[model samples]
Target chain A: MTVAADQPTALIRLGRFLRDNPVIPLILLLFVLIGVLEYMRPGIVNERWIGNTIKFAIPLAMLAACQTITMLTGGIDLSVGVVATVSAFVVSSLTPLLGAPSAVTISLAAAVLVGLVNGFGVGICRVHPLIMTLGTGLIATGCLQVYQRFVIATGSEIPSFLEWLGTGRTFSLPNALFLFLPFAALILWGLARTGFGRLLYAIGANENAAKLSGVRSWQVFLALYTLSALIAGITGLLYVGMIRAPSLSLANPLLLPSVAAAVIGGTSIFGGRGGYSGTIVGALILTVLGTLLTLLQMPEGARRLLFGLIILAVTALYVRFTDQS
Target chain B: MTGFLKKHGWTLGLLAILLTLLIAIRVVQPNFGASGLESLARAALPFAFATAAMAVVVIAGGIDLSVASMMAVTGVTAAVLMDNATEGQAVFAVIAVLLVGIAMGAINGALIVLTKVPDIVVTLAMLFVWEGVALLILSTPGGGAADWLRSIIAGPVSLPFLPEAWTFWLPNAFIFMAVAIAVIWLPLRRSKLGLSIYAIGSDDTAAFRSGIAIGRTRVAAYAVAGLFCALGGLSLTMGTGIGEPVPGPYLMASVAAVVLGGVVLGGGRGGLLGPIIAVFILRAIRLLLTLMAVDPNVTTIVEGTIMVVVVMLGAILMMRERRS
Candidate 1:
C-alpha cells in the first residue's frame, strides 16, 4: 500500500514508457504503410474506413478484453471464438421472434452459460484451461453448426433493430466503438483495484502459494473464466449487430487472432500477469494488419501467413522484454 | 477380472466406453461387425500419429497448435510430389516432408527458447502461416495421389491366418501408426533424454539445475513432434486417397483428443498408448453416429460434449488420484 501510494508517479512513468514503446509506433505503422501502398487510393481512412474499422473492431475488441482478463489470471479462454459463434447462432436464430433486445439477452445468456461451464471445468475441476476450453470450444462450434442447420435455417439475417446496435453511431462514431473502449476501461479498473481481480493474479502467479495464503484460487479462476465467456457473449451479439447474420464458419478464424492479440499485447499464457490495456493495442495492431492486408489484395493464404509471422515476432519481443521469472 | 480391473481401472473404464461403442456400431449396421473393428483401428491412425506428435512437445511443456496445418502442408507436398515424382524423387519427397516438419518444430523451439514467448502464442502464429501456405498450394477442394500409394494406404497388414479376405480389412494408416507407437514409447520410457523430457516438463529451472539443457531438449521434442505430424500427413493422404485442405482445424482437435486420453497438457505424464485409445474411441463414435444416421451437425455437438465429459471425467479421476 505504501509503495502503491507512491507509485502513481511510477505509474505515470510507466505509462509514458508504454506510450514510447514500439507498439505505439506499431499502431501508426499500419496506417502509414497502408497509406503509402494504397497511394492515391480514395477513402482509406475516410468515413467508410472509419465505420468499418470501428464496427469490426467492436466484437474483436471485446474478445481481446475477455482473453486479456483470462491471461491476467494466467489463463486463456480458447473457447471465446466458438462461444461467439454459438451465441450468434442462438440470438440470430431467435431474432425473428424475440426482436433485437430479447434475442440479444438470450444469446448473451447462452454465451455466459458456455463460459460458466468452461469456468467450472477449469477453475473448479482444476483441468487445464487450454485443454478444457478447447473441448468447450468444439462443443460450442458443434452446437453452432446444429443451431445453424436447425433453428436458424440457411440465409436468414438478423432483424433490422439488431443491426443498429452495432451500426448506429453517435456523433459520427460507431455505437460499437463508443461501447468498446469504456468496457475495456471498466475491466482494466477491476483488474487493478478489485479484491477479486487481485485474487485472480495471486492464483495465476503461484496457485499452490495462493492457496496456502488463503486465497480461494479456484473461485477466482472460476470468475475469470466466466468473465472471459461473458465478454465472448457481448462480442457475439455485437457481431450479430454488425453482420446481421450467423453461420457455421462465422467465428472459426477468430481463435488464432484473438489469442495472438492477447499474447502480443503482453498477456502471458503461463498465468498471473498482463493487463487489457496492452490487449487493446494488440487488437488495434492486428486490426490494422488485417485492414492493410485487404487493401493490399493479398491472398487469404498469404495474409494468414503474415498473421502467423506477426504473432511469433511479437511474442519473441515480449519474451525478450519481460522477465518471466 | 477384478484383479484386472484393479490394475487397469482407467483402461477398463475406457474399454467399457469402447465396448459400448462397438455394440452400438453392430446394432447400427451389420457391416460394422468386421469392418468396424478394422475401421476403428484405421481411423485411429492419423489422430494417433498427430497425438504422438502433440504428446512429445506437450511432454516438454509446450504446445504446437500448428500440427494440423503442418499436416496439411506436408500432405499437400506429398500429394503434389507423388503426382509428378519419379521413383527416386518419391523417396526425396518423403525426406523433404519430414524435414519440413522438423524445421517447423525447430522454429517453435527457437522462438520459445530465444524469446521466452509462450507456446500457445508461437504455435498459434504458425497455425496461420501454415494454413495460408497450404491454402495457396491447394486452392480448390480436390487433388491427386500416386496410384501405387493408394493401394498400400487402402490395403491391410498380412497378419497370420488372416486370409486375403480383403486386406481392405486393415488400412495402411494402422500399420504406419503401430510402427510409430513401438518406436516412440519404448525409447521414451528407457532413454535418459526421454526421462529429461518429463523432468523439464515438471519444472524447467530445476531441470536446468540438474544438468538438462532445457532449450535443446524442448527443441528436440518439438522436432520429433513435427516428424510425427508429417507421418500423420502421409497416412491421412493414403487413407483418404486425396489431399483436402479442410482438416487443418482438426489438428488442434487431435491435440485435445490426446489430452483427453489422459495425456497431461503441460507434459511429464501420460503415455503414447493412452491417447491412442482415445483416438480410436473418438473415431469409432463418430463413425457409428454416421451409421446411426445422426445429422452431421448434431454429430459435431455430440463430439464436443464427449470431449468435455472426457476432460471433466479425467479431472475428477486425477483429483481422486491426488487425494488417494
Candidate 2:
C-alpha cells in the first residue's frame, strides 16, 4: 500500500514538472527523432554529420532569432529573409569593389535602413507588421535588382574571414559556434535579464498596459526592429560564406523554415511566451529531419509534402500537450 | 448626394485613383485602345479573383497564405485533368478541381479549429503542402487545358451580328469576374454566414456572447475563400492555356491589391469592389510604367511605395477620426 501511494506521488510529480517546463518534451522529441535517424542508418550520427547539421542550422537559427524576437512583441519580421538576401548580395557584390570590411559595414547599414523603415511603418504609422515587412521586403528586392546592374561588371567574392568562420571545423565542432555561441548567449541573457527584454514580453502580453506604464512602445518597436534586422544581416554574411555564392534570391528558401522553427520551438505567434533556447533546438530538429528526408530518397515533391505534414503534426502535438487553454 | 458620398466615400476615392492611373496610361501610350483594354482585363482576372479570395479570408479575422498555392494546385490539377479531353470531361474536371479546392480549404479550417494553433502558423504549413502538391501534379509546368475552355476564358467577347470593335471592348474574362461576383459574393454578403464572418472578425468574444458560432463561421469563411481561389486557378489555366506552378508573384500582388483596396488587416471592414478597382489600378500603373520605357525593376519599387503610402494615409485618416 505504501508503494502504491508512492507511485502515484511520483507520477504526479513528473506530470507537474512537465507542465511547468514545456521545452523538456521538445528536447526529448528532438532526441527521439535523432535516435530514429540513427536507427535507420547506423553510424550516421558521427562527428561529420553533427558538424554539417550545425553548420546549416546555425544560419537558420540566426534568422529564426529575428522571428523569435519580433514574435515576442506580437509581430513578425517578414522582411528578415529579404534583409538577409540583401546583406548577402550586397556584401558579395561590393567585396570586389571595396574591401571586405567596408562591404560588410555597408551591407549591414542597408539592413539597418530597411529595419528603420519597418519600424517607422509598424511603430509610428501603425501598419500591421506583416504588411509593413512585406512591403519593405518588396522594395528592398527591387532595389537589390537595380543595384545588381551596377555591380554586374564587378563580379562577386566571399571574404576569407567569413569563409573560415562558416565552413571551418575545430575538434569535431563547427567553426560557426565561435560566432553563434556568443550571439545566442547574448540573446538568451538579454531576453531574460534586460529591461528591454522584459519590455518585449510586456508589450506582447498587453500593449495597452505597457503603454500605460510609460514604456514608450514606439521607441521599443524602433529599437526592436533595427536589432532584428541587424541580426538578419549578420546571419546573411555568415550564410553567404557557407554557401559560397550570393544571388538575388539567396536567402528566400529559409524564410518559411525560419518561421517554422520559431513556431515549433513554442514561440507563440500570438506572442509573449517563448525563448531562443527552444528555437536553437527547433533548428537542429529541422536539419536532422532534412537529413532523414534526403536519406529516404524521396522525390522533391514528396519530401516537401512530408516536411510540411511533419511540421504540422509536431506543432499540433506540442500545443496539445503544453497548452492549458 | 451627401448621403451617397458619405456611404461610398472610399469607393469613390478608389475610383478616382483608378481613373487617374488610366488617364496616365492613355497619355503615355496614345494608341491605348479596345484591344489593350481587353488584354488588361484578361491579365487582371486571375489576380482579381485572388484578391477577392484574400479579402474574404482577411475580413473573416483569419488569413490564408495558402490561397496562392491553392490556386497553383487547382490550376495545375485542372490543366492535367483537362489535357486533350472531351468537352464534357473538361467540364467534369473543372468541377472536380473546384471540389478539391473546397476540400483543401475546409481541411485548413478544420486543422486550425482542431489544433487551436494560430491561423498563420497552420496556413504557413499548408502553403508548403499545397506548393508541394502542385509540384507533384505538374513537375515542370507542362500541362494544358481544353481548347474550348481556353477559348471561352481567354477569347474576346463576340456577340453575333455586332461589330467586332464594339464587342471587343468586353473580354470574356471580365464577364467571368462579373458573373462570379454576382453569383457568389453578392448573395453571400446578404446571408447570415456573412454577418457572422464580419461579427467574429470584429470581436469574436462579443460574437460568441451573442450566440454566433465562431468556429463554424470561420470555417465557412475559409471554405468560401477556397472557392474563390479555385476560380482564380481556373481563370489562370484558361487564360494561359497551360498551368504554371509558380505562385509567389501572384501571392504578393494579391496581398498588395487587398491592402490597396482599403481592407483592414485585422479584419471586419472591407469589400470586394475596392479590391477589384485596386487590381485595375495596379495593372494600369504597370502599363503606364512600361509605356514610359522605365526599367522593369522600377515597377516593383513603385508598387511597394504605393502600398506603403496608401496604408500610411489610411492610418492617418483613422487617427484623425479617432481624435475627433
Candidate 3:
C-alpha cells in the first residue's frame, strides 16, 4: 500500500512495468539473440532462413498451442507426439487408397478416438495425466508399429498434395502459416471469449470448486483433450506435408520441446494462467534458438545442454514473477 | 480370509497375477525351463530396480523423471571409469559410481527444496540434461563394465535342493532385489527419515507443523531413490556389458511397473513388494508373448492396455475407499 501511494520514479515504474509484463522481456531477448546470431552469420535473417524457420517451427507451434490448452487444465498430453505420428502414419498409409480428403478425415478420426480414450482415462477415471497419456501413447505407438508391418509391405507414398502443403508457399508466405494462423486465432478466441474457456480456467484453478459451481468438469476435459489430440493430428498432417515423408520418429523429438516452449512462453505448468499469445512467442524463441545454435555449429550435446539451461533459467524467472505479484 | 485379503489385497493380488501368468506360461510350454526363467529375471531386474527408484520418490510425494536418464549416466560413468582400470580398481569404481548416483540425487533434492520448483519440472529437465551428459561422456555407447562386476551381477546363484532336473538356476537379479528390499527398503522403512517422508507425503503442512524437517526428508528420499537408480544403471551395465545412451522406453516401463504395483501416483499409499511383483508380471507378459510367437508390436499394445487397466483398478479402489 505504501509503495503504491508513493508516486514512484520513472525508473521504478519502468522496472515495475517490465516486471508486470514478462512477455516484453522475452520479445526483447529474442531480438537481441537474433541480432547476435545475425552478427555471427551474415545471412541468418534471409528470406530463405526465415521461411525454413517458420517451416520448422510450424509443427512445434501447433503442438505448443494445444499443449497450452492442456496445461491450462493443469494436465499434460504426453501423447501429443505419438498421436501426431499415428496421424502421419495414417495419412501416409491411406493416401494411396482413399486419396487426400478421405485419408485425412480417417486419420483425424483415429486421432480423436485416441484422444477420447485419454480423456476418459484422465477425466472420468481420474488418472493422472502423465500416466494416462503415457499409456495411450504406448498403445497408439504399438498399434502403429503393428500397422507398420502392412505399410512396409505396401510401400506407402506421401500424397503430392501433402508435399505441396508441406513445402509450398502462398503469396510469399509459407503454406504452413496459412493453415496455422487461423487455427491459432480460433484457439485464442475460444480461450478468451468462450464460457468453456472460463470453465477450463475454473477447473484447473480448483476442480472441486468448479464442480461445486456446477461445471461439468469431465465433459470439459473430454473436449479439451480431444481438441488437443485433433490439433496434434493437424500438426501431423502438416508435418507429413512438410517433410514429404512419414517415419516413426517424425514427432518423437518434439514432445518435450513443445512442453518447454509453452513453459518458456509464460504458461504456468501448474495451470489457470497463460495464453496462446505467449506460447506463439515461446515457440518462435525456441525456433530462433535452434537456428542460432545450428548457425553457430554447436554439437548436439552442447545444444541440448544449452537448451536445458535456458529452460531452467526461463522457468525460474517465470516462477519468480508469478510468486512476487 | 477376508481380513487377510483386506490387509494385503494389493500384495496378494499381485502375487496371484504373477502365479497365474507363470502357470499359463508353463501350461503353454512344458519344456520352457530354468533358462527361460533366468532370462526373464535378468531382463526384469533392471526394471525392478528402476521401479524401486520410482517407488521411493513417488512414496515421498515427489516424482523423478530423470531416473531413467540417471541410469544411462551411471552406465556411461561406470563404462568410462572401468575403461583401463584393473580388477581391484574396478570394484572401487563401482562404489564411486554409486556415490555419484547419490550425489546426483542429492542435487535434485537440493534444487527442489531451494528453488521450490516442482519435482516433476526439475527432474524432467534433468532427464534431458543427464541424457546430454551421458551422450557427451560417450556419444555412441561403446564402453564395457569390468569382469568382476559382470559375474556379481549375472553369475548363477540358485538355491540348494531346489531342482537338479529342471535346474532352477537363480540369476543375480534375485539377490539384487533381495538386497534392495531387505537391506535397503525395509531398513529405510523403519528409519526416522522414512517416517518423515511418509509424513510429508501424507500432508506437508501438518508434517511441517509437527516438527518434521520437510526439506531434509524429501532430499533424503530422493537420494535414496537415486541410489536405487544407480543400482539400476549398474544392473544395465552388467546385463549389456556396455553403456547405452537410450533410456527413454525404460523410463516409461518403470513408471508403468510402479503403477501396476499399486503404488498410488500421489504418494504415501503403497509398498515395495507390489512394485517388485509388478515388474515381474510385466516381464512375464512380454516373455509369454515372445514365446507364443506373437508379434512384438502386439506386445506393446498389451503393455499399454494392462497399464491402463491396472491404474484404473487402483483408481477405483481409492474411490471406493474414500466413499466407504
Candidates 1 onward: DockQ, in order: 0.69, 0.75, 0.68
Misplaced by over 4 Å in model 1 are A1-43, A152-157, B1-9, B141-143, B159-171
Candidate 3: tens digits of C-alpha lDDT, residues B69-174:
8888898888888877898999898999899899889988887887666787778777877777778888888788888778765645755776744334566667
Between candidates 1 and 3, the one scoring higher on lDDT is 3
Candidate ranking (lDDT, best to worst): 2, 3, 1
A260 Cα displacement, candidate 3 (Å): 0.9
Q: Write the per-residue lDDT of candidate 3 for residues A13-126, one digit (tens) a residue.
A: 655675567688788878887898889977758787778877888899899987899989899889999999999989998888788789899999999999999889888888
User: Top DockQ: which candidate number?
Assistant: 2
In model 2, which residue pairs have backbone atoms overlapping below 3 Å? none
Residue lDDT tens for model 2, A1-325: 3554568667556555655676788789888988998999999999898899899999999999999999999999999999999999999999988989999999999999999999998899888889899999999998999999889999999999999998888998989999999999999999999999999999999999999999999899999999999999999999999899899999988998999999998898888888888898888888889999989988777788888888899889777656632
The global C-alpha lDDT for each of the candidates, from Candidate 1 onward, is: 0.75, 0.88, 0.84
* Chain A TM-score by candidate, in order: 0.84, 0.95, 0.93
Q: Indicate which candidate wins on lDDT.
A: 2
TM-score of each model, in listed order: 0.89, 0.96, 0.95
Per-residue lDDT of B20 in model 2: 90
* Span of ten consecutive residues with least summed lDDT in model 3 chain B: B164-173
Give me the overall lDDT of model 2: 0.88
Give each candidate's interface RMSD in Å.
Answer: 1.9, 0.9, 1.1
